[model samples]
Target chain A: MSILLHDDTRVIVQGITGKIGSVQTKWMLQYGTKIVGGVTPGKGGQVVEGLPVFNYVEDAVKETGANASVFFVPAAFVLDAFFETIDAGIDFIVIVPEHIPVHDVMKMRDYADEKGITALGPTTPGILVPGKGKMGIMPASLFAPGRVGIISRSGTLSYEFAGILSEKQIGQSTVVGMGADPVVLCNLPKILAMFENDPDTDAVIIVGEVGGEQEEKAAEFIAGHMKKPVAAYIAGRFSPQGKKMGHAGAIVRGSAGTYEGKTGALREAGVTVLESPIHVHAWAEKYRLR
Target chain B: MRLHEYEGMDIFEKFGIPVPERGVAGTVDETLNIAEKTGYPAILKSQVLVGGRGLAGGIRPVQTPEECRTTAEALLETEIKGLPVREIMVCKKAVIERELYLGITIDGYSGRPVVVVSTEGGVHIEETARTSPDKIASFKIDPKFGFYPYQAVALLRRAGLDGKPLNACADILVRLYKVFRQYEAMIAEINPLAVLADGGLMAVDAVLEIDDSAMFRVKKMLSLSPEGRIGNRLERKGKEIGVTYVDLDGDIGLISSGAGLGMASMDIIGHGMEPANFLETGGGITADLLYKCMDLILMKPLRAVFINIYGGINPIHEGAKGIVRYIKDHGVTLPIVAKALGNHQEETWEILKSGGIHVVTEAATEKAVERLAALLNTSSPMSRS
Candidate 1:
C-alpha cells in the first residue's frame, strides 16, 4: 500500500475557481485521482469538473468526507487557506504555489506539527502514486507502476529520474516531491521513515541536491534504521558556492551544504550512490529492483 | 535581501538594542555634516550589501575634514565586491574593552532559528566557523516557544564569560532574538558587539537580511527602503519578469523550467563549454514572460543558448511562441538548442523548430547538451558530469 495516499485518499481542491486550481483539478481527475470536491469562500455553490464546491473547508469535508487537500491559492492568501485546512482536520496537504512568504510557512509548519497533520510543500512539485491516484501538478504520464519509492528535493530532477526509469521499464510505487523551499515541513529522514513502512515500496531512492544537511540526516537514518536498499543522486555537483542556483534552499553556505558532503554522507551510510540521475537505471539493475 | 549597515542599525535602534552613534549620508556634503557632528576620529563605512567591505577600502577611520571628504567621496563612488555603494555611514568611534559576536539565523538542517555567540568578533563568521570551530557556540530555538532565558546564557558562558559581561551580552542576545523574529529576517547579526570602556555594550557593526519572500506582509510591519532592496540590474529584472536568473562566468546562455534542470544543463562535463547564466522559469510561464526571458538572457555574454524544459503545470506551447517572437523581433543568429517536453509537446516542438531553434524532443537532458556541443562544432569527449 502507499504511505500517505492509497485507494481511499479523498482530496478536496482549495481555490478551485482559480485558473491554476481549475486546470490542475482537471488533470488530477484525468490521472485517476479520487478528488472529491473543492472549497472557495465566495463561489460556494459552484461546480468545477463535475466536482461540487463549498464555501469553507469544513463544509466541503462535511459533504464529501474529504480528508486531504491540495491548494493553488495565491501567495498572499495561502496562510489563511493553509490554517483553514489544518483547522478542518485535513490529514494531508500539498501546497503547489511558489513565493508564499517563508514566515507564513513557518507558522503553518508549527500548527501542522501540533496537530500531527502531514503537509508536503509550500513550493513542492506535488506527489504522484502510479496506477492508483495523484495529488498536485506532477505530469502523471511520465511515471510508471513499479516497486520503487522515490523522494526528491527538486521537482524537475525527480521528473528526470522517473522519466529515465520509465524509459528503462522500471516503474515507481510513489514519487514524493519534498518541496523545493529551504525550510520544508518534511525532511529526508521523515519521508524515508514513511517509505520504509509502505508495503508497496521495495527500495527507496533519495534524490537530493547541494544545499542543507537533510541528506546527511537521511544517511544517518538509513544506516541505522532502514532495512530496504537505498540509492541516491545529489544534484548541483558543480554548482558554485554561495550562489542561489535553483531553489532558495539549494545553496552551499560556507561548509555545510555542499555536493561533496551530501554524496559522501550517503556513500558512508552504505547507500548506492549514482553519479547522475540518468544513471538511475544502473541502481535499479544492480539491485534487480525492476 | 541583505540590508545595508545603516538600515540594520535603524532596525537595531528600534528594537532597543544599543548601537553606535551614527547617521547615513548619500553625498560628500552630507558625509561632512554627519562626520562633523560626531567630532574627531570618526568611522566612514560604505553602505553595501556584499561582504568583504573591511578590506575593500570601503571602510576607513578619518580624523580630519579633508580625510573625511576624500574617504567618503571615494567610498561613495566605488564598488565593494562589485556591489556599488550608494551611501556612506559616519559613526563616532568607540573605545572597546573587548569584542564579541552574536547572531540569530534560521539553520538549514533543523529548519529552526539558531543563536550563535563567539568571543572572537571583528572577524567574518564563516571564517570563524571554519578556522576555529571550538571558539563558537550555537543552539537551536524551540519552534513552539522560542528561545529560553538560559540558552543565551549558556552560549556566552562557553566563551569564558561571567557576571556583568555575561548578563549584558545575554540581554543583548534576547533583544536580538526578538528583532530576528519580529522582522522575519534571515540573518540578524552584530559583529563586534563592543564592550566599551564605560562598561556598556553597543553594536559597532550590524547585519540584518530580511527574507524577500516575506516582503508582502513584512512591508506593513517595518519601513523598508523606498527603492526596496538594491540588486544586480539583471537579477532585479528577472524578479520583475517572474523568474530566477543567476549571472555566472560561463559562455553558454541556459534556460529551464525548473532549477534542477537549469543546473543540470550547465553541469554536463563533456560539453566543455560553461553556462553564461542560470535562469529558471519556475513552472508558471506566459508568452510575455518567455519573450522577456529571452531579452534578459541575451543581456549576458554568450556563444550559444541551451534550453531544457518539462511542462507539467506550465503552458509551454505558449512559451514556444514567445521564443519565436523574440527571435524574429531581435533577429538573433546565435546557435540555440532546446529540449522541451510534456503537455502540448508536438505544438511546442513545431513552434521552436519553425523559429530555426534546434529542438530535441527526448526526455534525457544529455541528448540536448550533446546536440548543442555538435552545433557549436566541438568534438571534445561529451558526457554528463
Candidate 2:
C-alpha cells in the first residue's frame, strides 16, 4: 500500500559491522522489517543480530534473495559501495552517508538511472512505510499508518512533520527523506509520481527548503501531471544570503535558489504551501474533508 | 572552499593549463620586485574572495615601477567591497585579441557536471546566460565517460571557436576538466580565457572552488593556504567541534537540529531581539559535543539562549544532558528556553526540569519563540538568581 517499500521487501544491510549500521539494523529489526542478511567487506561469514553476513552484496543477494539495500558506509567508501550495490542488482538502495563528493553523486545518479535502480540518497535519513517496513535511520516511534504520504529534504524536519501528524491522529502512508544534499537521487518529482500511484495515499506533504531547483521542478510537475492533493512547506525563508545554513546544499546562490522563488512557484501550481512545519496536519485535515 | 585567484592559478599551472606568470605580493617592495621580473605593464589585482573586485578599483595596470609600488601600496591599504586586500597578485598583462569564457560546474538542474563556454567572455557569464542564452553553449559531462577530447572540441566548436583558437581552447577545456576532477572542485572557471594576438590562448583569470567536505581527501590542496579559514573565530570554533555556527546581528543565541529548523526558529522570533547566532548540531551529536556547542554559543553577549531540537538520529536525551550539564557547570542565570521532540522526548524534558532549567514544551516553533519573547520581556529587569 506504500511507495518503494512494503511487507515483502527483503532488505540487506551494507556496512553492517559499522557502529551506525549495527544500531540502525537493530532498530529496523525491532520494527519488524524483513532484514534478510548483511554485508561487510572484510567481515564475511559472520552473524550480526541473528542475520547471516557476507563479504559482497552479490554474495548476500545470491544467498538470501535480498532485493533491497541500506548502506551505512562512510562518505569515502560510498562510491565503491554504491557501484557494488548497483552491480549486484539491488533495485532499492538507501545511502546514509553525508558529505559525499558531488562528482561521486553525479556518477552514482547516472549509473542508477541507466540501470533502472532506485537510489535514495548520499546524505539521506532513509525511507519508511508506516507499520509495514522501514529502511534507513528514521525513528519509527514518531510515525503511524495513515493516508498522507510525506517527502522531505531535511531528516529532522521529516521526523518533526511525522510527529506532528501522529499527534494530530493523522498518519503517513510513506515518508521519504531525500537527503540534505544539493543533488539527491530521488527528488520531489520522482517521489511525487510514486505517491500519486499509491492507492492508500490520500494526499502528499512535501517538506523542502531553499537552495537547488528541485522544489520548482516539483511545482512544475504537480502543475502539469499530478491528480493528488499536495501541500508543501519551504524552509529558510529568513535565512541570510551567501551564508551556508548547516546543510551543504542549503544555500542561496544569486537569484537561482531562494525561498521566495520556491514558494511562489509552488503556490502558483495550485499547491498550498505552509509557513510552518506543524501546519501539515491542517492541510491533511482539509484534504480529508474534501 | 573558494580558493584565491593565485591559488587556483597555481593548480591550473600544475595541470598544464597556460596562465600568466604571476606572484603574490604583500608589500610595496615585493610588488616592485615581481614587477621587475614580470616586466612593465604588470597587472596588480587584489586578493579577496568576494566578487566585483574590478569595479571596486581592486585591479590596476601599472607600467612603471613607481606606479606599481604606489598601486600596491594603495591596494594593500584599501578595502574593496569591505574585504581588505592583504595581498595583491602581480602578473604580466596579456596582449588580448579576444576574451572568451570557459567554466565547469555541477548543474543543479541536471545533477551533472556541465562545461559552459561562451565566445562573449569576461563580463559576467551569469548575465550572458540570462540575456542571450544562445551566446553560451553548455555540455553536461557524463561522469562515467567524463569530458572526452571530442566532446570538448564539439563544445568549443559550437561556441563559434574554430581553427587554431578552437584547438587551443578545447585543449584548455580538457585540462580545466582535469583540474576540476582532480581537486574535487565544485567550480573551475576561467572568466577570460584570453586569446592572444598571436592566436594563443591563456587563462588570464581563474576561479576554483573545491568541495569543503572533500577536505579529508584533498589535504594538499587545502594546505596551500593553512590560515584561510572561512568564518570568524566563533564560527571556526564551532567547525572544530562538528557544529555549524554563523554569528548574526542579534541578542538571542539559538541552537537547533536541522539547518531548516535553525532558520525557521530564527524567523519565528517575535520580539525585537534578533537571533545572535545560527548553530546546528547535526545528527547523532553526542552530549559532550552538544555541551561544547552550548558553551560556544553562550560565549556571545546575548539576552537569552533558545535551544530548539527535533531529534531523529540525534536523540533528545543527549541534547538535554548537554544543556543540563552546561547550566549546572556555568550556573548561568540568563533566560534559557528549550523545546525538544522525537526520540526520548519525555525523558529529555524531565531531565531539563530536574536540572532547574525551564523547558518550552510547545511542539510549534512559533509558540516556542513566543515563550522566549515573553521570558525575555519579563526577565529583562530581574536580577540573576
Candidate 3:
C-alpha cells in the first residue's frame, strides 16, 4: 500500500565512492534500505557500505535487477547520471545533488518525463516508507512506520515535522520529499493522488514552502478528488520577495508563491493548516486521536 | 539575475530579435557621443535593474548633446531605488502605435515552459490578467518537445491574434525561446512589443532574468551577480558567501538549515520578536559559510540571534564549529540561541555551549526561540532598523 517505493524496489547508489555517497550509503544500509550495488565511473571495483560498486548503472541493474536509484553525484555530473539511470530503465530515481544547472535540470526532467520514470529531486532529501526502506539523505531517526502520508518540498523541515509527529506516537505511512529545485520532476498534486490510493495512508500532511504553487495545485486536487482528511504546514510565510530561501524553487515572486497564497488555497480545500512547526504535534494529535 | 537594459539588448541582438538602435555609456562624454550618432531626440535611460524607470525619471528624452550629457551625468550620480546607476543606455526611441506583450516563463504549477502573449501590453501583465482575463493568453509548452514558431503562431491565433503580424511575433518568440533556453532564464519578456505606424514589431523593452541556479553555466553572468543589482549590503554579502540571507526591517537575527524550517522559525520568533533577517544555508553549509552568515546578520546591530538547524545532509558539527569560531573571534556579547539536532546534534550542542550560545536540545524550535525572546526581553535594547 506504500507509494513509490515498495517491497521489491531494489535500489542502486550512483556516485557511491564519493564521500557523502559513502557516508549516506552506510546510513541507508543501516536503516535496512534494499540497496543492492553502487556505481562510480572510475572507482568501479571499490566497495561502499559492503555493496559491490560498478562503473555503469546497467551493469548493476543486470546483476541485481535494481529498479530504483539514488544519485549522490556532483552537480556537474548529475545530468549524465540521470540519463544513465533512465537508460538503465530504473523506475524510480532520487537525485541528491542540489546545484545542477537549471537548464540541465529542465532537460533531465523532460527526459525523465518522456521515459515515464519517477524522478525525485535535484536537491531532495529523498523518500521514505519508514521501517520499509529509505533513500537519499533523510535521517531515519525521525521517521517511524505509521498511518499518515507526508509530502514536502524541504528536506530538513520534513524531518523536523516527522520528529514532531513521531514524538506524539503518530507514525507515517510514507514521506516523500518533492525536491527543492524549481523544475523538480514531481509536484504535490501527483504525490497527493498516489497517497490517496494507498490503503496504508489514512491522512496526509503537506509540508510546503512559499516559493512555488505546488501547494495550490495540490489544493485543487484535494478539494475535488481526495476523500482522506489532509493537514498541511507551509513554510516561508514571512519570506521576503525574490529571496531564494535555501531552496532554488522557494522564491516569493510578484503576487505569487506567497505563504498566504499557498496557505489560503490549502485552507479553502478543507485541510487543517498548522500555524507553525510547533503546532505540528497538535495537528497530528487531533488526526491520530480521531 | 535581472539583466540590465543594455545586457538585454545584447541578448536580443544575439538571438536575432529586432530591437531599436542602441548603445551603452558609462560616462557623460560617452553618452553625448552615442547620442550624436543616433541623432537628436534619443532616449537616455539609466541602466539600473530596478523597474519604474519611466516614473522614476531614470528615462529622459534628450534633444541636444548638452541635454544628453547633463541627463547621463545626473543619472550616473543619482541612485534609482537606492541602487547607483553604473551604466546608461542611449537609444533611438521608436514611435509606438500600439503595444503587445510576449514572454516565455516557467509555469510553476505545471513545471513546464510557457509562452504568454497578449495584445494588451505596456502595463503589468499580471494586472491585466487580473482585471481583464481575456486580454492575456498563455500556452503551456510541453516539457518533452521543443518550442517552435508554429506552436507560438498557433497559440497566438488561439489567443485571438491573427494575420502576418503574428508570424513576425511568433518568429521573435522562437528567437526569444532560444535566449530563454540557452541562458536558462526564469523569465524572458518583451513588454510592449511596439507596433510601429508602419506595422512592424520592435521590442520596446526587454526583461531577461536568468535563473540564478543556472548562472554558473552562463559564464557572462558570473561577474555581474549582486554587482549594483542588490540594494541591500547584507544580502549582497550573503549571495557572495553562497547563503540565502534576506534583510528585513526587524531586530532578531535568524539562521536556519532549510527554507521551510527557516520560515517556520521566523513565524515562531515573530510571535515575540522581530526577525531582522532571514538566513538559511540549505545543504551547502560550511564553517566559513556559517561564519560569514553570522557576520552578515551581525552587520546590523541586532537584539539577539536565533539559529534553528538540523544536520541531515548538512554537517551540523562543522556549522556549529563555525558559529563557535565566529563568536570567539568577534568576542560576541549578544544573546545567541541555537536549536540544533540530527546527525551530529551532540557535538553541535557542545560547541555552541562552549561559545556561550543558549542551546536547545529538543526538536521543537519553540524552545530555542522562546529562550531567545526571554533573553532579549531581559537584555538592553539595541536601537536599529
Candidate 4:
C-alpha cells in the first residue's frame, strides 16, 4: 500500500565493502529488508554479513533480480555509481552521498527523467516504508506502523517530525528524506500526489524550508488535486535574507523563494499550515483528528 | 556558479560558436592594445557575474582607441552591481545590420532548460517579455534530445529570423546549447547576436553560470575576488557575515544546508512566511564563520534569523562551538534561536551548555517556531546601545 517501497522490494548495497555500507547493510537486514546482493568492483565474490558481493550492478541484478539500489558511495564516485544503477535498469535509487556536484545532479536528473526512474537524493536520508523495509540512516526506533505519510527536505527534520508523530502514537506509512543537495525533483507536490493516491496513507505531513519555488508549486498542486488532508510547516520562516545557511539550492532568489510566499501559497491552497513544528500533530488532528 | 560575459564567451569559442575576436584586459594599456589589434570601433565591456551590465554603465562602445583606453582605465578599478571590475573585455565590434537575442537557460518554474529567442537585441530582455511576450519565442528543450540544429532553426525562424541569419543563428544556438550542457552551466546568454553587414553572426555580449557544485571539475574556475556581486544591503550584510550571501527579492534570510537547506529556506519564506534572501553555510561552517553568520544576520534589516541544521557528522556541540564562540566574541546582539539535531547530541549539548543560549530540544519543529516568536518579542540590549 505504500508508494515506491514495499516489504517485497529486494535491496542491493552499492558499496557493501565499505565501513558505512557494511554497517547499514546489517541494520537494513536486521529491519527485515531483503538484502539481495552487494557491489564493490574489486571485492567481487566476497561476502559481507553473509550476503554475496558482485563486481558490478549488472552482476548483482542478474544474480538476484535486485531492482532497487541503496548507494553509500562517496561524493567523488557518486556519479559513476548512479550510472551503474541506471545501466543495470534499476528503476529505484536512493543516494546517501552528500555534496555531489550540481552538474552531475543535473545529468542524473535528466537521465532519470529519460528513463522514468524514481531516484531520491544526492543528500537524502534514503527512503523508508515503516515496518516493511528501510534504507537510509534514519533512526529505526522512532518509527511505527501508522497512516501518516511524511516527506521532508532535511534528514534531521524528518527524524524530528517522525518523533513528533510517534509521540502522538501517529505512525508513518513512509518517511522519505528527499535530500537537500543535487536535490532531484521528488518534490512535495509530487510526493503528496503519491501519498494521496496510496491507500495506506490517510494524511500527509510535509516539511519545507526557504529557497526556490518548489514549496509554492507544491501549494498550487495541493490546491488543485490533493484530496487527502495536508499539513505543512515551512521552517526557516524567521531566517534572515541573503545568507546561505544550509543546502546549496536552498536560496531565495528575487521574489520567488521566501517563507511568507510559500506559507501564503499553502494557506491559499487550503492546507493546514502549522507556523512551527510543535503544532504539526495538533494541526493534523484539527484537520482529521478522531 | 555564474560566469561573467568573457568567461561564457570562452566556453562559446571552445564549442565553435562564432564569437568576435576578444581578449580580457586587466589594465588600461592592455585594453588599448586589444582594441588597437581588433581595429577601430571595438567594444569594452566590464566583466561582472551579473545581468543588466549595460544599465550599470559596464558596457560601452568605443569608436576610437582613446575611448577604449579611457573606458578601460575607468572601469578596471571600478565596481559594478557590487562585483568589482577587475577586467574589461575588448572585442572587434561588428557593423550590426540587424540585432537579435538568443540564449538557453534553466526555466526553474518548469524544471527544464529552455531556449529563449528574441527579435530585439542588446536590450534587457525582461522588458521585451513584459512589453511584448509574443516577440520572444521560447521552447522547453527536452533534456533527452536537447536542442538539435533543426529544432533551433525552426525556433529562430518562428522568431522571424530569416535567410543566412536564421541558419547562422540556429548554428550558434545549437552550439550554445551544447556549451550549456557541457559546462554544466546554469545560464548561457548572448545579448545581441549582431547580423554583421558582411553576412556573419557575431556574439556581441555573452554570460554563463556554471553550477558551483561542478566547480571541482571546472579546475580553472577560480575565486577572482572576495567582493563579488553584492547586489544589495542584505548582500553587504552577508559580506559582513562573511558567508556566501545571495539576496533574493524576499524578506526571510535563510541558514540551511549548503545547497538544499539554503534552497528550502528560501521556498519556505517565499511560499509560507515572508520573502527573503537565500543563504547557505553548510560544508565549511567554522567557529569564525559562525561569528560572520551572526554578524551578517544582526546587521541585516531582517525580522528574524531562521537557523536549521541537519548535522551530518559535526554533531550539535561542534555547531554550538561555532555559535557560542561567535556569541562570546561578537555577543548575542540579535534575536537568534536555532534547531540543530542529529549525529552528536551529547557533544552538541556540551557545546550549548551555556545560560545565554537556548536550544530547542523537541523533535517537532514547532518548538523552534515558538522560540523564534518569543525571541522576536524581546529586544536585545545591543540594539539600544
Q: Which of the numbered candidates is closest to the native, going by highest TM-score?
A: 1
Per-candidate Cα lDDT values, in order, are 0.82, 0.81, 0.81, 0.71
lDDT, candidate 2, A26-83, per-residue tens: 9889888999999998899889999999999999999999899998888888899899
Q: Report the error of model 3 at residue B339, Å.
A: 0.8
Which tens-of-lDDT digit does each residue in A113-160 have in candidate 3? Answer: 778888888789999888988898887878888998889888888898
Query: lDDT per residue, candidate 4, B36-122, as tens digits?
Result: 898888888887765667788998888987777777878887877666787788887778887788777665544567788888766
TM-score, each model? 0.95, 0.92, 0.93, 0.79
Residue A229 Cα positional deviation in candidate 2, in Å, after optimal superposition: 0.9
Off by over 4 Å in 1: A243-254, B148-150, B221-229, B269-271, B379-385
Residues B76-162, model 2: lDDT tens digits: 898765556888899988899988888887777678877888888875555766677667778888776777778888988787877
Residue A149 shift from truth in candidate 4, angstroms: 1.7
**Candidate 2 Cα outliers beyond 4 Å, as residue runs:** A243-255, B79-82, B160-164, B221-223, B270-273, B378-385
User: With candidate 3 superimposed using the best TM-score fit, by how many Å does residue A35's alpha carbon deviate from the native?
Assistant: 1.4
Task: Give the number of the best model, judged by lDDT.
Answer: 1
Question: What is the Å distance of residue A171 in model 1 from its true position?
Answer: 1.0
Model 3 chain A — which ten-residue stretch has the worst lDDT? Answer: A243-252
> Of the pair 2 and 4, which is ahead by DockQ?
2
Each candidate: RMSD: 2.7, 4.1, 3.8, 6.1
Determine the backbone clash count of candidate 3: 0
Share of reference contacts found in each model: 0.39, 0.41, 0.44, 0.21
